[model samples]
Target: MAKVRLSAAAWGLSAVAAGTLVVGCSVSVNTGHAKPKILKDKLGDTVATRLAATTGQPKPDVTCPEDLVGEAGTTTRCTLTTGDGSTLGVTVTVTSVDGDNVNFHIKADETATPAAN
Candidate 1:
């Protein structure tokens, strides 16, 4: 009887540990940090083409790196620039993304200011 109880306790502890591990590693869909493959499949080609054309830069440099952060339902980045005269090096936060369209809010850094009209 004692041995059976001990085995049951061990099984229970193992189950709890497994559950905790699974929960801890679970990914949140809203976290903007979805799997890279998924993001690439969904927005990869389109984003690359658009950014390349808009920035007039080569294909390699226009790629989005992993570890891009998504905050408040948008991805944010700093020091991103296009090859063209128009620069987006300021601290820019994406507010929303719909299909190929992305809405962003830009907070200009002192070093990179907007041109006067």
Candidate 2:
């Protein structure tokens, strides 16, 4: 996992609460024959839940174009669309994989893309 430095305010978290935010989730993966993948919807839901919990806002809508491979260094871009149709870019990266669990990190863009007229 690469070192990431962001102030708590960046994530809408207080210094104390930020410490409690574990940015990863454990999703079941089949380890047998093929590379495991985190389903797109599941990944989006996980991201939405985490963001909502940290920001004290309703869960935002998230959409990913494809599944994320369950391998360290794997990354996928997802979009968080606001009520006004402005979009925030979210980058999700796989940090590590342990048998059935795929741990990942999430980072939201610093600014939102304004809604189109």
Report the Cα RMSD per candidate. Answer: 23.5, 8.6
How does each model score on lDDT?
0.33, 0.67
Candidate 1: segments with Cα more than 4 A from true spot? 1-75, 80-89, 112-117
Relative to the unseen true structure, what is the C-alpha lDDT of residue 52 in candidate 1, on a scale of 0 to 100?
Answer: 34
lDDT of model number 1: 0.33
Candidate 2 residue spans exceeding 4 A from truth = 1-34
TM-score of each: 0.26, 0.72
- Best-fitting candidate, measured by TM-score? 2
Please give the distance, in angstroms, between residue 58's alpha carbon in candidate 1 and its true position after superposition: 16
Cα deviation of 52 in candidate 2 (Å)? 0.7
Q: Over the stretch 58-84, how does candidate 1's per-residue lDDT look in tens digits?
A: 321123344333343545333323233
Q: Against the hidden true structure, what lDDT does model 2 obtain?
A: 0.67
TM-score, predicted candidate 2 vs. hidden true structure: 0.72
